[model samples]
Target: MSTQFLKLVQATRVPPLMGPKKRAASTAEHASPLGAYLLDARAISPGNLAKALALQLREDARLGDILIANGWVTERDLMMALSAQYGIGFADTALPPHDLDMIRSVPWELCLQYTVVPWSQTGGMLILATSNPDKIPQIRAALPPGLGNVLFTLAPEVEVLKAIALGHGKALARRAEAKVPERMSCRNWATSLSSLVVPTLCIVLIFNLLFHTTMTLAVLSLLACALLISNVIFKGTALWFHLTEDKSEFHSHRDHGSQTKRPIISLFVPLFKEPRIAGPLVQRMARLDYPRELLDICLIVEEHDIETRMALARAAIPSWFRVIVVPDGTPRTKPRAMNYALNFARGSIVGVYDAEDAPEARQLHAVANRFAIAPKKVVCLQGRLDYYNPRQNWVSRCFTIEYATWFRLFLPAIKRMGLAVPLGGTTLFFRRDVLRELGGWDAHNVTEDADLGIRLARLGYETEMVDITTHEEANAATWPWVKQRSRWNKGYFMTWVVHNRQPIQLLRDLGLRKWLGFHMMFLGMILNAALAPLLWSTVVVAFGMHHPIMTLLPEWAVWPMALVFTLATVLTITLALVACRASHLRFLRLWVPLTLPYFQLTTLSTYKALFETVRKPFYWDKTEHGAFGGAEHDVQTPEAAGIERKPVIFGTPIKDTAPNIQALPDQLTKVPVIKVGTDGTIRRIS
Candidate 1:
């Protein structure tokens, strides 16, 4: 279910089509392809199908006892792929298609399932055309020895199933896989009263009764409220993460030529001045799952950003992947680029990703799969994002943990709580028509993802998490980190502004519980992160054992201060525990105490964002890499905890475009800094 694209293999080796042969059952020359055009007689490679079948056969013990176990096909496909990979006898196609009888209405995927090798010394090409390619390997691996690389898969399931039972053992006839349940039970009991809920409730009730409604009571309510709202956000993010990791429903649907498989999808990649990322991302268009002719991959580059346009052209992408050079004007932000991109996008489904993303190979597959299962209302799938190299320093590790919790636990829980999810910057897949109906990304809103999520909720379209994640590089250094964080904070502030533009409509749509969650998750993030320093300062004095415990105030004053600070501390501690547990950072439990002091440190970013809001509302705060770094932070494998960094970074320093990749066509090796003598080319700055 690569709701988009799971793999984009650059197939440079497909050979000539064999001449059509008359099938006993159907005409070979003209059959409508049921899934993708890969169903044509010339499409399937017998070597590939045999490889898929052999892989499946080795795994199923029950199926392992069939004709395949007795040297039927003899793992020939596996040997072929290996041979091709190893450059062993990788011959130019010596055999012509006209000499062989070509089979049709079979999908390439099905051919692989049954070991129906496409290119052979034999005189025919067997095509597999069933919608459920998953079933192909199942039947093929167990086929009897004499049937080797000779069977063709049919598009109609009834015929395919019959053929499978005849070729394979009768075991599959009795098997029907169970459908997955829509909802799972809450695994952890945060609602249970025994551990702390009952005690906290009793204390709050007693305090209210004794104090008779004071500021202290008001504060208690905020604490309890934050606990509830954050829980929802945290859960939603985690679910999306898990769903992306599991099998998608997009791939589960079987086609006996049923009319449901081909929904159109539109993809958007918005770039401002990022020419460095434009080509690699555009190159990824070849991997999409939807028909290449049907899909539209819009590359939205700024009108003035000429380099990105040139970079995209260097790849010479097909018409399906078009470049939309946005006209230069005021309000140059990502949402603005998206607004322009949406105007030209043509598909039933719509999606948007950052220019720097290389999502999981099967990200779109997951989106497609999820959409297939939850077709009635699941129109959008927000993918999770994590820097592949997040541990470049203490800040990046912290950012990774924060993102892991936000996307994996918080956002999903928010969605479950019936609140809108604020999508991350990349890999957002959507239904194109639905997006147009909603009026596309908001031109005025700064954090377009959050704004659009709210817009979806308003329109009654529910978003499900696709089992996909995008790999991004974290800001390489500290100055870069602060700058980047500042931009994000500013955008969230702008989101708060634009959404509030229609407050009455929101209150009506979200109701009380959901609106509360929305405010706590989004609004609360801004306030708490900005105000933590002032709120937590008093508590630190009491918590630190080394500090002299002095009762400076008279007896009358000390009691209330103690109780008030204690409650705020509880509020702080509770949310901290929730966020930590949500991210599965049990190792960071020790660091929690250490992190509290620094939690206030994040306040500086908020302040910077606030001041910059007026001057640069949509500024791209470039996060630099390589700060707090000594040696290279690259690792062959992912690390649970360590300073991680993707050694390669793209683009020129954010401030300058003259000397970077944008200058690729130029031949200058180094800058001739000064034209000292007015001679045309030889002056070096040094």
Candidate 2:
């Protein structure tokens, strides 16, 4: 899988390799050369030739050969057209004087089929002769034999699926759409039982107590349950839609909507204590194809962390790059440092990446090109993020699958619905000034990206997708991953609080549809993150403890309710795996089943994070990131110095949950970097 396939399919006209105004030759560009026969359009019809032309994957293929192979156009018509254009009779596919490069470049199939006008031939000479007569004459003059060709021509419109079908055959096209039933996630399921979904039983109980009529309460509870059921249905639908790949852009009518300027992009990398990730981070950043002068790649560090600062200063980076230091004492979370960087950033577009991420090279280019052609109304593009070390262990595999579903399937579907997309923690690009207009990152909010996206949509900017994906380091072990997820889960809960704090304003800004979507996204994350685990564990307990779920119910209702719950629980988990693609049966044997129980740690960790959020606001757990390198790691602390790690920085974490999070002082509980103002004024909060 060379990424070139995706590149060719979705490429937009990029500025020249060197500058902003010059354009590169795109997949759609046409070609012309002298000393070759000129194939005329009259020789064949586009529709008839299109079928055969599709077989030739090569960009340079003979137009006449493809049309002839497809059997829609005639060799007589092509020869006549070529003779008229080049003043020579149509001859066998031969390299005319001065057309050697053109012939070799053209697909062999196109030459054989068009130049010889054959009905059939050996599978050799792979090329699709198209209906375009102009291309056929060129192929005759340019191409040589031995290259097999398939006949084809451009159609009025191509069904991408149709082309895929031609390559894969009828069996695949007839394959059934997935129908997996959702089931409980984790096998043991303790945390899931206690937390997450506020139980349906709780709803029934509330109805009984609040209204005091058994029948009435039952009916009311059923109605509430119906609403919950509907919510679940909608969530499933949302998740389903994103699984497909789409490149259409969101647009609007505007005066200054021309796609001329190549937006200046600011890349932000939020660095914490994980110095082992520096090399990967730097490499990913450097690998980006975006012009160096146009890119503002910032390696953000805390002012108090001498280690991170030293590593950054010593790292080789472009002069356009910078190390922004936030003061050590205000908001300890990542969002705070981003906010500090936002004020000084000078790019039209802004993006955020984690210290351990290595995004695909074309992401920035994709974002830019997508924006250029997209409906000018969108203000942000969310690229996908997956695990770089997904197979590191059972824990990493589960996390990777979960992330795959979220980023690949869930997020894209949400974007399609025109809802407020949750800005992922990384691979998010935004219009810089739009971010500032909405008041930069929320210094107080832990999940700044999600909150900012919501606020931006509310403030009249739209969010869309570039459909680009990137890779990030997966938490190597269960405990560490849980700790990290717990923090994120807690931050999402906080995001809900801040937005709902002013319900009236929210309603006015987002309107009902958007407001509903936002509520679902916000509450959905919290509820799913909570309830899925609870349900998982409960099912296990019911089966294990023989808790008499049906025995406790009324005789008439026992079977029905039990059946429904059991069915729904199963459906939920099954869908979870399918939507997420939790390894095929083969991979499952090696990766999934063994890791099932541990995956529930998400619920358990979430609960821990819930309490931690209340007890210690702005806790910054220093994620330990060196298991891959082992003793040979870089960024080691003084204590680790005697071992293999030497060049890496070991910073004092603010909310230290990992090895030394607790050691951070109360005074240094916030952000750790600061920047001097124009008058040389500096704030020493850290």
Candidate 3:
């Protein structure tokens, strides 16, 4: 069935031509015109031709389109007939060496709008390939006045489209290349100094001043306390908003009524390595409950990643899935690959998913419904993200708790308060037009998602949180987890620096409330991670070991210092539990007592991140997956890992755990079976 449909679609785009002897005989036999020639040549039957002519009279489409739609004549046959009748040559798909110069002669927009490509220029004539050769006058009119005589040649519609994508893609790539440092790279002197050099100098200066003056030590202590107080207040406010906000406004179920029509949705999955996960990724995507014809999935692979490319080739992928090979370039990152694929997206809505993501089956439908009901100013919808392998190790469990806090509590709270929401990397959907207007993702930015979210707010576009989840693999090992966290921390630092480049303008763009939120979220988070160890070390030494550092400070400062530590600890623990409850990971709340140690891990990653930012700023520290657990248990599925999927109502989980099963081909779907016990714990049904 797939083969037959593909044949028909291809036929309409580029028809198969007959042998030269047969073509000449038909042409010589029938000199009436294109339609009569096709009919006489038996390229199209009398019934199809008659039906096409009748439909052409009522519609604005060309006769060839109608004929092809009705399966009467192939686009190749039509183009051949038209070429013979008009006494023009059929353009070759092989791009010429002079193509670049010709492309520069025409505006990119005009070329795209007209479906015409400048083929070559010779002497006084500028040659062009267009399926609609009859529109030569209009095409010429759209071109700039400096060009000489315009010549038209026939080409298959597919070839013309290919040419357009190629030509426009090259132009976009050139533009992207020029802006690489500004957009993605952190090699600039300002970023380097801020991320590394300044921090080092500040630390050295603080220690020197501490040895020389008690006033300097007092000032440093007060500054640290100020940052701590601001961090606690930010968390407290977000927690209050999370608890007090009306949850009924955010619907978990899809609005079926709003989905009057299924719009094409383009899903981009950028893969680098991990051949082991390819089969699973394909199966997961295949389970998406969307009309096959309306789902455009692009598995973007780097041109050099042969292992992943081969793995995808071996997978039982559906015909609708497209593999886009990103060209080799600098700042090779996921965002760069996605930017390349953006040009080929055919959907009105575009979504990004990681290679390991397993988004809900109806995620796209829900996103579409939201888009339908939303105002034009709402350009992006960020879905919740959690780890499927949370119980795989202590690191993963802590990571999951952290994610639960950010995605379930903090992000939703910000969205509710009408503040800028820093977008998570995966499970994010955008309006195609708006995304293009914003120039897609910054190829050079490490945390393009967060950067884009801030950019959207600066440009007066709003992002809302959708009540859906995409399960991803947690970094289970300590080193890998540290690497992953370091990248994230580095990205946060970069995002802060990039957005804060024009502080006055940013302050004007985002009002005072939002501007403060942005600072607390990005810069404050960095400070928290970097300074937590220092504060913890001081407390351990002064209180735990009864050290003399406490004697250096004034007597009045001791009470306030103890109060800040107590308050911060209490607020963090309370918020962690709240986040767990909100995300249906209440069982993980047991790990709250270990939060201090968990944060210490983050401190390690933060310092590593700081160093990397100065040394290899744009380097992507790839996280390896598929290692699910430690010695206690082997690798397992989500169910085997004891994770449950539950719905949240009014920030509370209802005790129901029946999996929403959607049947698909065995080779294309692999949902793990889960069972919920009376104690509210989830276990594998096997």
Candidate 4:
């Protein structure tokens, strides 16, 4: 027999494989025993086979997957051994040319869901190639009719996925870009424009008809003061709830039974121009305590992002990790990439993480355990996020304190109040079925996380907060921080506009109390930051400086305004300090008072966000990572992996090396063929 199994190992790829040395064919080639065949062929040692079998029983995974994940045998070798064992054939050569009609016969979505691709035609029968031959029966049953007789061929999972993408990438991109209903999407320009334009014009017209320009301005200033006070009051209520609530729920740990079988969990780590962090990312993910066979970590990269692709190519990616190359398309945002990658996930649970995240080791176990015990309506679990370099600088310190206050105190309080929880971007896990049923995400919404949370609530789903945390890099620098904050604010503004487009419907979807809370959270956040200049002008009265609105205001209004300002300040400081203490960051309590200056930075970011909301609503401001050397790892440099580093130019057109795209000849080359029946009986044809 030829050394066909060795073709499965790709030398230049990350997580380099060790192919078995060529030797004589096994004497038991005609036998149908997988372990015995591999051992006879010297494909795997006996010890590795025993270990893999034990893991297979423990994880409830396939023996092949366990061995492949552990690097004991290549995927191709396993498939080839299975071919010999089951009397089937292996599709060892390059994939055939795109048969558009054949591809159209079966839905690519179904193909992705089952890991199968209609490869080619032979003997008037369709040949469906799959990485998972064990699922052939299910795939056969689920496939749409009209393709006469079908046969199955074994191929590597990655190769099958790449072929499917190459054939249907554009369609997938288009669908992913607009998966959310048009009514809920911000992509509808007319609706977005009317939502913003009508509100502003009416407010202005009302002011013009009722009062003079100066009085109108004073009224607007007073309105800003009122909204700020309302926000303060709302937060105070949430703070009270947080203080009064039992701490046991906040710190409780999920008990994962010793013998409980954990389901597979897939995490999507989206990367754009992030070249340097790939090595560290792999290092961080390797720390996860989830079983190797059950952990599906896909590195989501754009098809044209050659820099990141090269970085991934250099890193030592494990055998189980998948690099999903998202086809280049419009509004190249993170959510869109995730939506496209969602089809390829192999887990019942799905999650998302940024490139720089280092989640707790037992985070997956906690999520799985919680999901196992919690009600089905609890479809999502959001983990707390902190900064890995909290004390890097004053900016970092303030940023950390802000996060502590929100994730540790305010968000939990909001959840307890039964309001829509605007999800943070990272460390969020969801039930796969519910996520798909909701059509994934609005790709056009820059803040897809928050939008998804609201959509879940509208559909009567709940998102519980998991106690584990994932530490991320803090944006310590000034310019980067502004850009990042602006993106988030822009997302919030867009989410508010989209959800409020049909205000009556929104009110119906979310009850009166939640509706009020939603407005207070989104609109209040935006207005407070946008109108901070007006509110800050009142500080001049304290210093006896000439103040515009404060001097013109009546005594009754003045006293209340001064009192509200003092109360807001005291409440904010107290919440931040208490949050720090709870989060075991008591040292950051001093930085709480310093956050007053930090809060001013959002004024600049809010204006920038407003500008971007009008100009480019879907543009994602990619935050560059590796600034503070994440997670304290001594990672390998790109040069060490034989790649020269170059400065990344934002928005530059990426060159495509476009590897492994060779087309096979019309006829099969040395690959055997077979005939399969509707009942999945295999009969050798060649």
Candidate 5:
């Protein structure tokens, strides 16, 4: 049945002319006469053609792409028309059988890059199939010399993709599994774990044996205090900068011309075991204020995650949205899934979002405009992330205040100081080329975003913080929050290890100042969390409670240590309060004093993180989403919550108009059938 289907599909293809070389299109062909052909065939209305033509002028895009983007014409129809116009044969419904020899002639990366694959050989000519005709010339230029005669056929992108997946999915998946270079990856840590550990443990043991136990304890205490003080000072500086930053620059960004031609932005929302959020995810994405025609959203799911695939199939997926099934591979991390799905993305600017994200309406527009005006070296923009369910519980309120502190104050200060900005997993946009050049992300690194940010700095690219905010579901429960925080801390440890593998080289790449900042950020964060209890113990002295550490510290050291502890406490509270105020989360202000106790939870997470770093470093501790009823259960809009309209970034926060999400009958009775098989293939089964 498959062979017969292939044969029938092949029959529609018009093979390129029989020649050693095909002639280039005539001057008239560049004028996009395909629109007239579509009109004559009645494939698209006259008004649709005019609209696409107008967009073509502004976007400088292909008429067929514009038409297809608008959903004015089916992709198959566009390919058929292009086939007629160019005299290239159309590869219908399913692609013909692959020629392993011909496929081997081209590099796997090149095939994915151009969206073309070798189909079969006939009459001393190799027939190549492609979804994108514009890439043909580039493919031709890249082909090996001995592959003498070649012809091209136009196929619908879905068919071409299926062919590629069936033929090379394993090889591509393996490559994606380890895109980061070996020295830069912590994937092989299992081998070197002992080598990296034994020496450090031996030195500490030797020191303990040489010195008296009390002296060793005193020394450790002093070192921990020094690290704590330095980390606190850094946080203080960042907070001070945030308080005094000139608002005029942000004001200018708001008033900057919006006439810049907007590019198609692609977003990858990686989902694993997130079935519950699929419908809500679609509804949230639909609220984006960008042109539907230009939005390309790929909801990526692991091959084994049937629940998510089923959930997505049951939803009314917009034409602009695509469901990408990631082939199964090791590590099974979000970055790995994104690395595989990146091949299928169709935009020059790629962003990432999580399953439960609900970005402000104009966020994409803000991103496009900022990218338009930003310098070429500014390759990344990290947006602010907040929570919509901050009022859910004590955990959520504390989470909100912590996020406000990080995004509003800490990140902005880091960017201002020319330090590497550790990227948050979501609400991040990057230049596709630079992202690809950096090898996407370290699949084995649990905190791929933070690792990538350091890599960006090492490569001399800059990351700027944009004021745009994306509201998401905060982990409102206790144990779940610990698991999530542990995963993040574990990633930080791995990132620090990978980057510092070659300290002098990293120092040269990041420079002296940034090198220090990097240490303070990663090492300091690790220390602060891991040694938080050390400082917390000092607080007992204020309560006049007897503490064991008093025996180790001299009388002179006691007063200074107490003073430093007090200073750090004040700085932390002050920073959190300022960030909370800046976020306009006035109701959470009363919770600021309790944050010290709140952060003790992180100390527990730090132990778990340490244990996991040695045992399951690559494991992605999945955070469950849609745990709290959000937009559907709460007041519909931000205004309804009594939130004032103000520029958090560049524009007023838009109202959250809920999407029409009536559940469909079982088996997706009323919806178009978008089937993702266990092998990770998407088949439109209408």
Candidate 6:
């Protein structure tokens, strides 16, 4: 054998042969013992044989096939060895066709699985050809009753695989056909009618019955007041719990002592249209601190997104990162693409990120550590999301404030209070098994993240908050912001409708408190957005026109209505201020007074979302990122922007450093002093 072949055989572990033995009396003793004979004849090395045996222990392939695949030994070498050792003739592929009865004796599934085929049968003996001839005894045991003596012959692995494919084509097709329907079925009409149509009809009927505008205004005001108060109560409770709760308890402290045992993490980044950020996105992912070998990062791109594909091709993506092309399907939504990629995921823990996301480098490590320490019922973790481009424009600034308030204050409060956390769209990690059990993402739900969060609660699984940040682009433009918010509102509508299809069942599953929380979070948010403009209009019209609308209301209702509106406004402003302080965006405090006007923008999206909910419930209004320049412009930190950092105390960061500093005693305070350390440990030098 050539030196190259020998080296190849050494690497592949082709079996060695033993010294020839005296002819055995029993036929069982003659069953293909070519490996030992080859070793004895110096056709293969002992070390190679040991290696092949070690590989065989771990895999389901035969030794000969392994050697052939590795280019260590030829088929002819194996054929000659088998003939000499077994004292049996090779079965020619050109032999006459076997009877159909003989062929049907072994099932096609068995043929495909074992890579064996029944070639011919003669007089109480069935001749079988297999790449793994040594497995004849096992194959015979699997044959149907009434089959007699089984004879085996060796065939090349490639030829065997080809024959199996040809013979089992129909069976394979049937198996494939069984899976397509599940992926294709995306719509759920029962949810549509109950969630959208009935609600609309009820609203119209109530408005028509009232007839007069005064009664309608009173009822709308009352409904809006109730929603506002309920939100205040919920938020107040969350803030209270957040303040009192020992947040350190939620942090996982488990050390990753063993590198080998670290679980594989599958990250799915669903990309569409915005190809300009692909290279940067890949670079950001590559910067993750997790072991590259254990990270299965899949960039899910739609089949029709040629520009993104080309962009990715041009980017210097690492070998481990995969670009999975999602096949064209209904809804063409992010969740649909995610669901498709879930099948190809090869990790125990799965995470999702967006194209523009730049998650904290240690996020995967934190997620894995949390999962390791979390209870089995805790199946998901949502990381905090904030905008890096908050200073881009007014819209972006307001958007960041809203996000910071929700993520930093509201979400933590929700988690601390033990309510379901309506998950954010990205930087969410899930237990792979749990995600699959929940059927992954609902392709037809535009806001699949929130829907999935509710589903997790309904199924008795908990989603915890991971203390990591994933910075993404804040929508800086009007139309794009409206479209994105509309999709979210629409998805929330779908989730509420779908889960409420069987109200009693949902209530039973989630219990009364969670059921109520679900409504207040999903339904109440929608109500707040939709009713914001109407309520603001009432206040504006009543104040500006000297009580034009207020005059129509009953004399007794006017004072109470005014008081309710005043209280709601004060509480909302307080919440915004607190949320801003908690989120370390004290700069947003200046904009807190403009909360009403900021929320008025939401009305546009709410109405648009309502229409879309009725007309095209599953339409995904894609939020195009990279619009406000690139990642570099979007990832600005507050400290980098010359903003002073404050220490967090009791879930709220201090607003000013000035208050903590005491003026030096009159004699020693003559000279100016500067602060240096984070703890405010000052060094004064004159």
List clash counts for every candidate, in order.
56, 74, 3, 1, 1, 6
- State the lDDT at 644 in candidate 2: 24
**lDDT of candidate 3 over 1-686, digit per residue (tens):** 01111111122322222335544654464312456547544687543444343333333345665566445677678766676555566665554324566666777777766777877555557777777766777887888988868777777655665666556666655555433335334436344445665468568877878685555554455556788988788788889999997876667336434424446688999998868777778777776765444568899888788999999999888755788777677777888888877776767899999888878776876887788788899999999998888876688788898888899898988887778989999999999988988878877667889988988998899999988899888877788888888998888888887777668988999889789889888888887887665576557544555433455566566678788889999998998898888546978999987766877888888889888767777889887655562111232343544444322221122333222312111212222333322322223332
Q: What is the model-wide C-alpha lDDT for candidate 4? A: 0.76
The candidate with the higher TM-score, 2 or 6, is 6
In order, what lDDT does every prediction score? 0.47, 0.52, 0.70, 0.76, 0.75, 0.67
Looking at candidate 3, the ten consecutive residues that score lowest on lDDT are: 1-10
TM-score of every model versus the real structure: 0.52, 0.55, 0.73, 0.82, 0.85, 0.68
Point to the candidate with the largest TM-score: 5
lDDT of 5: 0.75
Greater TM-score among 3 and 5 belongs to 5
Each model's RMSD to truth, in Å? Answer: 22.4, 26.9, 13.2, 11.6, 9.7, 16.7
- The segments of candidate 1 whose C-alpha lies over 4 angstroms from its true place after superposition are 1-259, 283-291, 315-320, 540-598, 618-686
* Model 5 / residue 481 / CA error / Å: 1.1
Candidate 2 lDDT, 1-686, residue by residue in tens: 11111101111211122121211221112212110112123444322332222222221224444444335455555444433432222222221112233233443334323332221122333222223344555654554565445432221111211222223222221221111111111111123232332344457657776676545434444443444465566656765664454434322211113334445678899887756566546655666655443467888877677776766666666544667666565446677677666644646788998887767655765676666666556888887777667666777777776676577567777777777778887888887766766656665555667877887787788877665767767787767777787777766766665566568888998888788888776766566555553344334434545322233345465355456555555544554565555343225334434444665576686677667555554566656655643213233232333322111011111121222212323323232233222322222233
Cα lDDT tens digits for candidate 5, 120-152: 666767777787786788889998788897888
Residue runs of model 3 more than 4 Å from their true location after superposition? 1-109, 112-140, 144-171, 178-219, 259-262, 540-553, 582-584, 627-686
Q: Write the per-residue lDDT of candidate 1 for residues 303-365, one digit (tens) a residue.
A: 678877777778657545666666565456666667555544445667787666655543554
Q: Candidate 6's residue-wise lDDT over 595-682, tens digit each?
A: 6677787888988988886677777788887877555543344334443332211112223213222332222223233322332112
TM-score of 4: 0.82
Local error of candidate 4 at residue 72 (angstroms): 5.2
Worst 10 residues of 6 by lDDT: 1-10
Candidate 2: worst-modelled 10 consecutive residues by lDDT: 176-185
Candidate 6: stretches off by over 4 Å:
1-186, 190-192, 195-210, 250-260, 540-560, 582-584, 631-686
